[model samples]
Target chain A: MRRVIKNLISALVALMFVNAAHAAGELHIFNWGDYTNPDLIAKFEQMYDVKVTITDYDSNETALSKVRPGGHGFDIAVPTSSHIPIWIEEGLLMQTNPNEMPNFVHVAEQWRNPDWEPGRNYSVPWTWGSTGISVNTAMYGGEINTSELFFSPPDELHGRINIVPEMNDVMNMAIMYEGGQPCTTDKEVLMRVRDTVMAAKENWKSIDYGTKEKLVSGDVAVSMNWNGYSKRAREENPDIAFGYPKQGYPLWMDNVAVLADAKNVENAKLFQNFLMDPENAAMISAFAQYANGIAGSEAYMPADLASAPEIAIPAELQSAGVFVPPCPPEAQQLYTAIWTEVQK
Target chain B: MAETENTSSVLAAQSHQVAIEASRRNKIRNFRLLSMPALIVLTIGAAGPLLIMLVYSFLKAAPYGGVVWEPSIDGWFGVFLKKDIFDGTISIATAHLSILWRSVNLSIQSTLLALILGFPTAYFIATRSVQTRNLWLFLITIPFWTNLLIRTFAIMQVIRDQGIINNFLIGWGLIESPIEMLYTDFAIMLGMTYVYLPLMVLPLYASIEKLDFRLVEAAYDLYATRLRVLWRIIIPLVRPGIVAGSILVFVPSLGAYVTPRVLGGGKHLMLGNLIELQFGQGRNWPLGAALSIFLLCVVMGALLIYVRVAQRGTTEHV
Candidate 1:
């Protein structure tokens, strides 16, 4: 028995060393859940001989909290446009050297030189989309043109409507519905928007962060969702429609950044560059259904998904939508305070 | 001179014995030092995360994605400044409170129901052969081996539209349309009750099994009615079990997120969900931490009040 136990202990020690060695080449990526297919990671492993470890955060704030402790565990993370400046100013992200990444040239023109990350310094754009209403017309018996479906849903639709759990989306929707610019940091405008949302909260059933599953489950009639998730949800149940309200939608982007203390720096950079490649980017976009930042990837996308009028990029409509910039701490504080108070 | 030498030798031996006793006490102290790892694990696993959250609440969100180290009242102001919004019908404060109240109310109701159902069942088993009692106890523990989320999701699928219950209703031509059974408050309450019922039963069963039946029979022989005998003899003995069961049911349900998310639909938002939104899409850590502290304060305050009330009630009967 003693000899057997000694053998078992040696085997366990050997196994631990094997796992530690195997984990060395692996890059741990933290991003939105279900944002990419597992097959993409397998394909990347086959091509690059680098293992990929993927973990997902349901929201930007959740991802930020995990990466805040000086990049202890995660090598690559996807954060929103609003968080880029904050992450850069804190030195949490490693500066992206354009020379090192040749595939950076394929990024969409609109993503380059954005006010948030000037000169393409710290982050690389992965995917971009808009926040709009995803409604089941069959349930509503008509079309939804405004954010009212979420803000002031009909009595029958009460408890059936799903709103974004975020204050930015909620407050922005209120501002847009009230004929105010969605991105305005004007105090009076913000207060009015807050009050409007507060009034709407009484009848608000549930605030949902992830939508595709909820919309398909028939728990919600109308939901505020990203264009990609809405499209995905509609594919599962054909009766759903994703539409931007008559008021402009909130345009947001997820950017991939290498952490300052990344263990697998080479693998992390390689992964970012790999994602930038048009063919690989197309495979991701086609499966994820979210629009990618790679310029030439559109050519590689399927004709049905690419040319579909709903998913097509209209230059005029794109310009009208607001790109979220990192606001002052005061504005964020005010937004947070109002959101909590409203929920209370 | 002889007496002095004898006295000194005896004193020396006595002092040596005291030294030996002190050494034994020191060894016990060393044992305590070895057990310190458990306390460190508890502090790191629970209090450490909460303390980090508290610290982050005071900091400002930097223009880039990270938080600025500068201390500010901005986070507190953010939560407090929305008083008008909180006062409004759609306010999160009201919603959070209502959800919490509903969860507490449901948990309490279910606990009472479990006590009623489990007491006699446990008593009968306890009175039976020891082998039968062991089998019954084992059956009660079988469900706990599975994950909570999977079990809750299973319950959801059973009652959901196109689920077994809905299909049965539709097949029987009981209704033209699938009943909106998933998102309503009723479904949330039902799920909470089901999840917590077994928890209440186990504790109650333990208490009921230890009960002395002779005391109840003596009370009945004294011409006490069934209700009076139950209240005076049986209930008083099982009071501790009831309190233990209630705490078990109440604490877990207080912060429950999964059941409401899956079974409650979007209709019923709980305090857990509100706190989640604050950290999640809300991007408001200070407010989320504040809400969490608020919940902790409420739980602590209620516990104090309950202990006092329960003591008084028990003392008065005595």
Candidate 2:
């Protein structure tokens, strides 16, 4: 027994020495739940000999609030495009200047100088998708390319529809449907936004996440959903289809950046540069079923993702997809009040 | 010689008094040292977060999410009032009021229903033989072995549109369409009642097990009906248990977040969800903090009322 204990302690010390020799460092990533591609992380870990830890946040606000106070110990964070400016303005994110990175040239020209990150200094695209209407054609065979299907649903659609409970996404669509812009501070538009959603809530059965499961389970015939989730749902139930709201829809993109107070700044920089590579970017898209901004990454993506209507935007509806920026404090307050009333 | 002897005796007496005082002080010091960790845990670990919440409720909300150090009453005002965006008319926050009403209403309903369902089960178990009573109690706690969230999901599986109850009813040709249970008020109430039923049972069992059957039999011998005996004798004896069980069920039900989210289908906001909304997507930390403090006050108020009523009941019974 004594010999066994002695051998065990010796073996543990030897293992620690081996680990000390090979290990480079550790990288902590805070991203959306189930959004990180495991394969990409595994590959990065093998190449760099660094351990990576991933944490999840359900919404941009959650991530922001958690990271804003500092001492979070997260090396990297993924913030949506709308929230990127807030993170930057708050000095929560480091200006890593990914535009100067070696693989940055592969970033698509359209995404190269996004409004959120001019010159792409601080962040790189993680995933980009649109929020639009999804419907099971077998339930309602009407034109689904309009927000009217939700805001003023027909008799057949009433009590059979689900609404995604995201405040910004829902409010942006409602405001746009009432002929307002994203983050508009016009009082009249804001009031209409309130009334529109309140009336629509009467028709909506639930406001929730887990759209794909609800859509596949025949729980809701129609829902306002993310395009990637709608695509996944369509695969399960062929009757289900994605509809780009011609009235207005949100084009959302999540971007990855290093924290200003990151302990492992070098490792974080390496991870960010790694994400810009075509193969790595493609892996991210393939896992999350979303699009990446790397131009050559599509060639590496699955053929189905490349050809699907959900992935590719038609020319006519292209003008309708609008990017919602983070609202100012006053407008956000107004929107929150309206949303709370609607839910109540 | 007498003077010397008196001095020695005096010194001995003073020293002995000093030793007694020193020993007493040592004992108190040891007690403080031994209990230092618990005191720190209670004050800092438990009350520290609550103190932070109380402070945050008075601060200004940052542009995005965090709080600013500047103190303001706007957060408290936002809890009960809303200003119109265009008209500038200040009105009662009907939305907050209604959500508050729904939470209380559902909690009351669940408590009442649990009492109705649990009293008999507890009585049946309490009356069983000692071995069987132990077995019954073990079975009563079986649901607790699983997670609260899992138990809620289990209830959802039983009542969903395509779930067991609906399918069973339809298969028997008793219904043409599945009765819409999920996402309705009924679904939330059912979830709360079922999830908290065990809490109700355990307390009632603890009280009923100690109940003497002689009084009940004596009441019956005097020509009292079964209902009268139960009401006049059994209920009074177990008043503390009922109060305890109701508090255990009602408090958690009022703050219920998961059951409503899972079974209630997230159609509406409960008090808990509304507070979460202000913190999360609403991006109003002060408001969320204010709401949470408000909820804590409401629960404290309810507990105080229960304590008073229970005290009154005990006094009246005596």
Candidate 3:
């Protein structure tokens, strides 16, 4: 009986060790809805022997508001470029310093040290895309590569245009249309911005987020659309094509960062480094049809995708894209009022 | 001896009746005692969120979509008035009024539409035999089993340009081009009518089923024509049902966000969507809270009016 008891104790201890080995850790990721690539998650989970769970938020405000007060139990989050400074100022994110990670060299030269995250202290680029106009070639074949397609649609496309419900994108484009920089505080520019959009609203059929479905189904012949969604829509309907708006467009990037109070700090840091790898970053781009800032990720992407017009902006038009960062509280209030009046 | 026994039995019967009445009173007291927890839960559950909303509405707006601790009436002011962005002149918030008007307009329109459509349906069901009546009701409730979002999407599928209706029209060469019907005010109204039709029908059926049709025959015997009998007899009898159905359809329509969002094309703002904007991209939580409370007040006002009319209708029934 004594010998049997000894054996049972040893077996129990062995079982506990096995459980510990199997249970590496768990990571809870809060990201934009329908944005995360499942393959990348699966690969990361297998690589680190950790469980990965993702929750989604539809907008930057939602992401910020939820994470602001803490206790969200999220290890990582992907927030848009415009809201990054706000998140940093709120101290909701931990400085993971991706520049110190092994995979930091894979980040493209231009994106290696952005003004928002100098030396990549806090975040890594998850995906980047531009908001531009997408037109159905069969509808009106005229100059589709311009903001005029959205703000001053031709007679043929009148009442057939759809503007996406992104307030910043619409307001920024309108600002640019009046020969002003984005997030400009000048009252005159802001006034023209309001007037331009308000007048444009008449020609537009809808201001909606589901422009991809609307475009593919031919519900709207023209739409102010995001590049990735336009790419997906074009895949469904070849006649639907995306064009970089010449009168400036919004260049936005969603960055992955660790939460300040994350329990799995090591795992979160590992995931941040994992996203910088070319193959993994390429997986993200493939799923969302967005462009990743990883150097040589294109080698892993499909030939059509690597050279897709929606992915590759032309030379002259490349300079037209601007990253519209967060406006100050006062400027934001002004913009909000203008937005309300426009939609109202 | 027989006289004595009969008197004793009568006294015993009267005592037994008294005992039964006493026990019934005791049971009522026990029921009230047992219901305390549920009453407490209801009061807390329903009123707690409302209290929070009331408090939030009076607070100052935070920069990035929350309220500051400081109290201010800016939210309420924003609801009825606007400080112009350009000239900095304060004026009546016609934009807000327009949204409010849209919500009210849509609710009223949908209620009437639901009545016209549901009245006939409920009547048809009520006129059927007992076996068929339940089957027809079962059919009316079949739509409810599916989720509301799914139903709205199904409507979208049926009406989109490349969807079944357009496809069918084009296939048969009925018209040269497909009609754009998916993203109009008509579409919003149609979706609402489809969604809340059952709410209208059920109440109308409950009252119509209890309707005394003998009055109709009596009216006819008094030389009342078909239209006159319908106006004087059937309509008057179903007044309670009409009010109930209208309230049921109208209240939800006023708070409707999904149907209008899906079908209204975002060209116009409804009250529910406007409130949502304040909480979301508009980044003004105080405004959202104020808007929510305002909606609650509207709903309460509606309910109070309904209660008064319903009381009168019930009294008239007796």
| Model 2 Cα shift for residue A343 (angstroms) | 1.3
Candidate 2: regions farther than 4 A off? A1-22, B1-37
Candidates by TM-score, descending order:
2, 3, 1
Question: How far in Å is the alpha carbon of B313 misplaced in model 1?
Answer: 3.4
TM-score against truth, every candidate: 0.82, 0.93, 0.91
Tens-place lDDT per residue, model 2, A166-261, is 888989998889999998989988888787888888898888887888888888899999998888888899988899988899998999999999
Tens-place lDDT per residue, model 3, A1-344, is 99999999999999999768857888999999999889999899889999899999998888888898888999999988888888888789998888899999999999987776667789999999899998988877888889998888778888889988788788888888889998898999988888888888899888887888888877789999999999999889999889888889999989999989999999999999999999999999989999999999999987788789999998989999999888776777788788777767
> lDDT tens string, model 1, B1-318?
999899998888888988988998998988888878988998999899888777877887544334578886656554433344223333334545565677667556655666666677666766778888889888877878888888887787877766888889989999887776766666766777677777777777788788898988899889999999878887788777777777777766777788877676544566777777666655556666766766777677767887678778778777
lDDT, candidate 3, B14-102, per-residue tens: 88888998999999999999998999999899889889999999999987778899999999998888898789899999888878888
In order of listing, the candidates' clash counts read: 20, 0, 0
Candidate 3's TM-score reads: 0.91
> Who wins the lDDT comparison?
2
Comparing 2 with 3 on lDDT, the higher-scoring candidate is: 2
Global lDDT of each model?
Answer: 0.73, 0.91, 0.89
* Each prediction's DockQ against the real complex: 0.29, 0.73, 0.52
The top-ranked prediction according to DockQ is 2
